[model samples]
Structures are given as C-alpha cells and as structure tokens.
Target: MPFLISPVLTPGALARTPQPTLPTGDGLLLRPWRAEDAPAVHAAFQDRLIHQWHVRSCDSVEEAAGWIAQWQQAWKDESQVQWAVVDEETDELLGRVALRQILLGDGVAEVAYWTVARSRGRGVAFRATTTLTHWAFEEIGFHRLELFHATANEASCRVAAKAGFTLEGTKRSALLHPDGWHDMHFHARVHGD
Candidate 1:
C-alpha cells in the first residue's frame, strides 16, 4: 500500500554515504567512534551523572566495545547516528552527540548528548550539538529535530536552548532514570527554525 504523501526523506539516504566528521569552533571535532574509544567510554560510564541519566553503564572495556559496534551498525541501518566528540588538538574524547530514533519517512530524529566531567561548563555539548544540528538540517534535509531531557537537568535545558531548539512542552513521566520516572522537557527545531 502507498500513501498520498511521499516520504519526507528517502530510505537509504544515510546508509548511502559514510558519516562525516564535523568540526566546531570550540576546538572540538565530532567523529565516528573508534575501537580505542572503548576504554574512554567505559570510564565515562563510571561517572555517576552519566550512569544515572543514560540508565546504563559499561562494566568493562568489552561491553563498551559492543556499544560502539552497535552505534556503528545503527548508521548502516539508517536508524541512528552517533559521533564521538573529541579535542581537535589532542584527539581526546570529550563527549558524544547523536541523532537517534530516526524516522526517514518523517524526516525526524531525537538529539542526545553527554560530556565528560572535565568538559562540563565549557560549552562542549552546546557547540557539538549545534554543529550536528546544522548537518542534520542542511546536509541530510531533516524536516525537524527533537530534543528531550529530564526537567531536573538544568544544564541540558541550557544546551538545548543554546543549540537553537525551542522549548515545546513537557511530557509527564516520559523517561525512566535510576531514581524514578522523570518528566521530560520537549524541545524542537524545524527546518526553517
């Protein structure tokens, strides 16, 4: 069966090309995850905040490697894409930014990110997310992008706003964290916005 309206973006759009490395003005580069990143990823998971917000931890380097493998596969599947945000000069992992829950037909995805403890308060997440947002809208032709964060996460709320996402509304108990369900603040940016 076919619908009257055509798909917003054709399938295989992402799978057709390799993910590109994006650079930010703040001396950061968002690149594909590498095998060597497993140790950094595992170490990052040990951060209490990361573990609490993401609701998962890499117990060992092997498990972190598996996570990286899954992220790589997601790009080929056209279901999601993730980038390891690293220092431009040193190539040290600073954070991560991703567009997950991608819907090709709808031309939409959810933005997610996290920063290492040292990278916090330095605008790493904001810069990386802004770069990814531009790529998603201009390069890939996404119609809209959505971002959600636990309402209690004031820092994340700031990042969303800094990245040009408008606060839309709140979803009650939309996400489950280690402590309990969290009310999520919904933010979005459309093609023109």
Candidate 2:
C-alpha cells in the first residue's frame, strides 16, 4: 500500500548526520549535549523559573547525565533533537533549545528553550530559537514549527515574537503546571515565514 505523499523528511535524515553545531552570531553556539555538561545542567534547573516552566529538576549531576543520555537516544530515534546553547569563546553553558514532538510525515515540530538565570534578559533564547528554526526549515525540510508557552510567561512571548513566530491563539487551561492549569499561547511559523 502506497501513501499519496511521502514523508517530508525521511527517517534517517537526522540520525544519519551528526547534529551540527550552530553559531548564533552573538557569542553563543548551539551544540550537542555532553556528559561533562551535567553539572551545568543540574545548576540551571535549580533556578525556580526553569524548574517551574520545565516541570522537572535535576536533583544531581547523575540525573542530569541521564537526561543527556536520553537526549542522545532521542536523536538516534529521530523523535526529537536538542542542543545545548553555550558561549562560543569559553564554551560555558548558557541555555538550551530543541525541536520536540516531531512529525516527519506532517513536517511539523514544537520548539522549546530556556536560558540560564545569568543568560536571561540578554536575548539568548531568541537567538538560539531563531537559529534552530532556520535549521528546521532550511536544513531539515520541516514545513511548520509551533511554540506554546504559558500565557503568563511574558518573556517567552517576547522571544517568540522576536523569532518571527506569529501568534495563533490561546488555549484555555491547556497545560498543567505545579500551581495549576494555565492558559497557553500558541505561536507558529511555516517554511516561508
């Protein structure tokens, strides 16, 4: 049985290639996660906002290492791809950006990211997200990318707008946070946009 349309991106398209490191032109690079970066990951999670938005925290370096391992496996499985945003010069961890919930046949995925406490307010998230969005559309052939965040997350709204994702709408109590269900703002960008 043949389908009317082929997958926009083949299964091996990502797994066959080593994930490339992307430079943000603002002193940061998005690279693959490394075991040695576990400590930094653990530290970043300790920030209340990061933990609250992400809904999980690394209790120790070991747990962070486990997360790194999962990220690697996700790449191999072609289910998701993540990058550690780091300083270009010192190679210090600054944040993270990822394309998650990918649907290859549909040519879509969700964008997610967070900046470390010190990296906040400096446009790190916007730059990293824009870089990943470009790679997703130009390099991987994805047609649509979606970004959703709590309506209360003003910072994320700014980043989404800065990265050129158009506001779609808001979902009523779409996601559950530690405190309770929160309305979510839906934003998206397509291949041309």
Candidate 3:
C-alpha cells in the first residue's frame, strides 16, 4: 500500500508538493486527517447535498469529530484509508476521496468520494478519484476497483465515467435509502491498458 504525506504540513506551506510516491496526481494532494481539520471536515459533510447521497446525517460537529477519529484509527489499522483532499496552490480542503472494502483474498478494493458543494463544478472529485485509483492500481497492485452509487446520483455516475470506470450494470433493490430499497449502479475499472 502507498501512503500520502502532504507538504502542506511543512513550514511555510507554499511549495510544490513532493510527489506522494502513490499516484495521487500532480496538482492535488490527499493526506491523512488531522485533529485540527475536524471542524472543516464536519462543515463540509454538513452540506445536505453530500449527506443525501453519500452518507446518513451527522447532526453535530461532535459527531463529525468522532467520525474523523475513527477514520484515523482505520488508516492506522490498514483496514481503510480516507484522504482529505487539498489544493496544492492554496492548501484548502476541497473534499475527500477514499478506498475501502479491501478484499485481500480477491485482490480488489472499492472507491468512494465527495467534493465540497462550493467546489462541485470544478473537477475536484474527478481528480481525486483519478489520483486515488491510479495509486490503488499501481501501488497496491489491486486488479479491480469497484464503485457504487445510488441511481439518482447522476453527478457520481458522471465522475466515475470520466475517470474511465465502466458501468457494469445496476443492482436492483440493493441499497436501502430513507425512502426504500433502491437500485444502485455498479462500476469498475480494471488494471492495465
């Protein structure tokens, strides 16, 4: 597995990011969550747009902090890795993208992501997903990267397609939403050209 270390954590915080060794892209960096980042992460997840599609509601900042702490521990355990995406030029937390569901026996993994509402139209998710997927394939040597999204999430579908994942098909009645069980699109990108 590859790791991410942000040059943003350095003194001055204004320089080219040293390549993450993992293929997390050139213009953006994905690094581990910090305790100081809790407030912003909480605020970003609070966007109704994000919660409706990505996760259940997290009602308060305290709840968000708890989630972040858990995420940190997960990374330490090598069970899952969630990244906080930040712009290299400005060091602002643009969003988050993660790779989970590590199936070591199958040599496969699943990718998930979200971009801050204010940053939606700017290709943040696409870049983050691309970077993460490239790292997963090249460094982790995973054979398949899977993605799932609610059928109503057209934006997510578009991002996955743009990242070169093929939509395998939909799984009927696969996910339980607030309304009811709903179909989900299954997409994947395999290693190699």
- Model 1 spans > 4 angstroms off: none
lDDT of 2 by residue, 6-95 (tens): 888878878998888999888999999999999999999999998678767679999999999999899999899999999999999999
TM-score of 1: 0.98
Residue-level lDDT of model 3, residues 48-131, one tens digit each, is 887678647777778878888988776655556788898776768888888788655456778999888888898888988998
After superposing all C-alphas onto the true structure, candidate 2 shows an RMSD in angstroms of: 0.9
What order do you get sorting by TM-score, best first? 1, 2, 3
User: What is candidate 3's TM-score against the reference?
Assistant: 0.83
Badly placed stretches (over 4 Å) of model 3 are 1-26
Least well predicted 10-residue stretch by lDDT in candidate 2: 49-58
Candidate 1 lDDT score relative to the true structure = 0.94
Clash-forming residue pairs, model 3: none
Per-residue lDDT value at 138 in model 2: 92
What would the per-residue lDDT of candidate 1 be over residues 1-193, giving only the tens digit for each residue?
A: 7799989999888989888899987799999999899999999889988977887877999999999999999999999999999999999999999999999999999999999998899999999999999999999999999999999999999999988999999999998888999999999999988
- Cα lDDT listed for each candidate: 0.94, 0.93, 0.77
**Model 1 clashing-pair count:** 0
